[model samples]
Target: MDPLYLGAIVAIATILVLFSGVSVGLGLLIVSGGFLVIFDGMRSLELMPEILFGKLDNFALLSIPMFIIMGSSISSTRAGADLYEALERWLTRIPGGLVISNLGACALFAAMSGSSPATCAAIGKMGIPEMRKRGYPDGVAAGSIAAGGTLGILIPPSVTMIVYGIATETSIGRLFLAGVIPGLLLVGLFMAWSLYATWKSGDPNLLNGRSYTWRERFEVLPRVLPFLAIILGVLYAMYGGIATPSETAAVGALLCLIIAVVIYKLWHPRDLWVVLRDSTRESVMILFIIAAAGVFSYMLSSLYITQSIAEWIGTLEVNRWVLMGAVNVFLLIAGFFLPPVAVILMAAPILLPIIITAGFDPIWFAVILTINMEIGLISPPVGLNLYVISGIAPDISLKTILLGSLPYVACMVLAIVLLCLFPGLATWLPDAVMGARL
Candidate 1:
């Protein structure tokens, strides 16, 4: 009969529904609605309409659809093929150069697209065949694409950052600014691991003893500069407060379209229609999740579960370091079973309050949490990246991709530990830029 007990049941039921193949939006709505009716009676039904409308009314949320359109459009237009070709020409001299190039291309594409699946699909299609033709091992090729793809969320213009900012009421612009350095750091780490792996494989012949001309190396730079320009333009506008997040997303989308149409001359009027339709579909799904998450988050608040959990964690005498380490472990475990978006939506509400109560910076926690999600992308069982790569290389078993990804996963874990030890890695830019404004 207790509200707390009933709330617990509803929460469990929600998890069951998700695991049993129900849509996340529908599961959250069903559970939240069930709790409202059982706990607050028929009078509670009146609140649903307003709650749903309020959740959808968020102006900042408009950025989601716009950015998705931009990413999908750029992706469909095959703009990244140019960047990959340029990178390949520059990196082709080294052993496992193509593999290393795959990582670089994915990182660049991620900065542009900000979606892991898109990054994986685009770069994988190009890189996998090249690497295979060049005698790279199947596992290595698959792992490289899968691991590199995760840079999408870690890099700027990231949908993950936007969603986290919306949930925690943090400045999305500041969060975007904060991710730039750390994302690049992870890319560097992955590059280092790829080089080391190549060296360890003992295939000096893989280098093909090839070298590029000075003129040729310099030539590719110009072709790749546009991708860099678009990313920097979006981030610069957001960081400078020259544009709001949604406005910047709109600008980025238009810029991507122009680049495809005018610069690349690859896009046509019909292509625009397809991009809009796909973006609308993806945006609607994300918005539905956001709306349902808002209702579920509201229900959690009404039940005092967040407050209770925060109070309990706050009362503990453990070191802050221990708490953070525990949070990383929790996130990794949760990622194995839940999708990254769901993991963030469900866990952030509960864990964030505890994090803030313990005097940790919310933005730093967001970065740390994002890294943990990256690990989940490569981890076995439910690693989405693994599946994405596997779909590309059906011959390579899921187990092999997971095994091959281990070193990159270690690199990510090390990156997280470094960031945890030196929170400045994550906080410095945000503070330097945002602090001056204040």
Candidate 2:
């Protein structure tokens, strides 16, 4: 059989398995192993153990668990609420201030957590009700947090960026820095839309908000500032060349635990155990997927499927931007069904070379891919953030949430276009700070 046809089969089979509600890691393992046995025989199965172990053995991959622990520790405490309240106090007087504050909280929490679902669950639980209590529309109330939560994958300390970095052999720190400007850009776009929507509606209740005293604004700072400090510390350590990603993550995780215990008094053994257990579950799931994806990539390579695809792409005479548009569309479709990490593990490798050959920077493309994933978070079928908002605000219908998110989705596409025009938004910070990488 032609390797291209086999590639199609693998693609279709993987999509079918994942959409059929199979666990991501287990599903990938099944697809890869079955293909290996059928095409390469039982003898090829021997390499599976080595590939799995070898993939997990990556030094940088160690950061994944630590980062997960950091997020778990924070979410287990009152940090998310405090963060939102702090922002709400500062932004209270502006039109659509409640929604704007929710987005600000999401971006800040994303820096701390790096997991979209965690960001949505924590901030949405607090932000949604507060916004609704203040007369914010249900769609805007729910949509804002859902959109904001997608920031988790684009900000520094992001798990998705870490996964992308390791998968592509790009510098994790560079990728982290790469995301900073674009992440902020996306937040700006979201808040701008919220402000415009509310102002344009001319609803006095949504336009005018409660005022907070200076002291009230300052109240939650003590609790929230430490988490912000951790985000800055992680970025500084990694970008300043003071630590590798794993080292920064290890220290960041420790700092988060200390802050959680000190500020929130969650020092009980049971609380600590819950944090550990949660992080362990998430970390294991990610690592298992990475290992499985390693074998999957290996199978594609062994079968010449990946190489053939690359060669086929090289022969295309289309404009570079056209190719990029097509790639983004493919990524969007894939992300609508699969989570960001799985999508990155499965697709980034295959696309990186094609992107570079087309005269695009890999780091800039990482930002693009991330924005696509962000769009997916609010999109349907597997819109995890949408479901998260649904759980947080049971009264709000999913259809309304999705409808509300459409504007923000447009914002994301706009961000992608802006990045394509500037490119520097994703690359400048990293290059400025670290010097250019080969």
Candidate 3:
């Protein structure tokens, strides 16, 4: 069989398997193995163990599971709830205060969790109910939660960034550092959009005036400050070279455990076992996906698909910016049909090469790619965040959630444009800290 034909068939089969609701890892494994056998015979099976082992053996990959454990432990502790409550008291004087505070809380939670679904589950449960109780429109409540959930991918400890760093052989520490400014920028954009939406809608739900006294505001701060301190400590230690990314993650996980058990008193002794069990389950799922993606990527490389795609893209006479725009459009469409992780897995090998060929910084492009994925999470038909929000707020119709998310999506696009125009927004901190290390 022609290699191109084999590639086409494998791609189609992989998509069909995914759409059929098979687990992505299983789908990739099956499709890659089947293709390899058909094209290269039974001996190709020998490659599977090596591919899986090579993918999993990376020391950098250790950070992924540790971060997963950290996120789950933190979520189980209800630390996010306390942080949201504290933010609510402090922000009540502003218009659309609860919604603003929701974004703020999501950003704070994003610092710890780094997984979109986890962030949504953590903040949405608390924010949605509070927004509703405060008389905010259901659409507004749903939209805010959905939008806020995306912050997880943009912030530090982000699984997506780790995956990008590993995929491209970029510095994980630099990638994490690069995300901080853009993440904060997006959070600010979300808050501003919420304020503008409230102003335009004349929504009575927004709290106005300086209602909370200084004493009351200060009282709530103590509950949330420790989480912030932990986050800062992790980033500081990593930046200061006191820890590698994996070590930082381990320390973060340990601190999360201590916080859950001692400070919040939310996790019972029995719950520790549950957290470990859940973490193990989730980590296994992630690792399997990574390993499968590795095999699929290997198959692509063997077929010279990456080289062909890069050469084909290089032939296009368009300016680099135009090419990036095209890539963004392609990613947006792909995001609608594919899961973010799956999209990243499939696209990174192809796109990273093109990006490097185009002379763009991989770290900056990673941040940009992540923002696009965040937008994809809220996109119509297959937006995972929309479904997550709708699942929790079943009373709100999908159309309403879709419509409510439009403004936030627009803000994400704007954020992307800003990052493109000002690459320094993503690159500055990484350069200042990592210097020539990148």
Give the range where candidate 3 is weakest over 10 consecutive residues by summed lDDT: 201-210
Cα lDDT listed for each candidate: 0.82, 0.90, 0.83
In order of TM-score, best first, we have 2, 3, 1
TM-score of each: 0.94, 0.97, 0.94
True lDDT of residue 338, candidate 1: 73
* lDDT of each residue in 1-438, candidate 3, tens digit only: 555565667778887988898898988888888877877789999989999878988999889889888888788877788878778888877777888888998888877877677778788888998787767777778887898888888799788888888877889898998999999898898888777776776756465633777888888776677777888998899899898989998988888888778877755768898889988998888788888999989878877767777887788788999999998998888888876677788888889989988878888988888888888889877788898888887888999999988888988899889988999999999889878542
Backbone clashes in model 2, listed as residue pairs: none
Model 1 per-residue lDDT tens digits across residues 1-438: 555465567668877988888888888888888877877787887888788779888789989887887788678766678778778878887666777788999998987887888888888888887777767776678878888999988788888888888888888887887787899898888888777776677787765535778887787676568767988888788878798989989988888777777766655778778878888888888888888888888888877777777777888899988988898898998887776777787777888988988888899889999998988888877888888888877877888888888888988999998897888998999889888333
Cα RMSD to the true fold for all candidates: 2.1, 1.3, 2.0
Global CA lDDT computed for model 2: 0.90
Per-residue lDDT value at 433 in model 3:
86
Stretches of candidate 3 above 4 Å error? 1-6, 203-210
Q: Write the per-residue lDDT of candidate 2 for residues 95-180, one digit (tens) a residue.
A: 67788889999999888988888889999998888878877777788888899999989988889999999889998888988999
Residue pairs that clash (backbone atoms under 3 angstroms), model 1? none
Full-model lDDT, candidate 3: 0.83
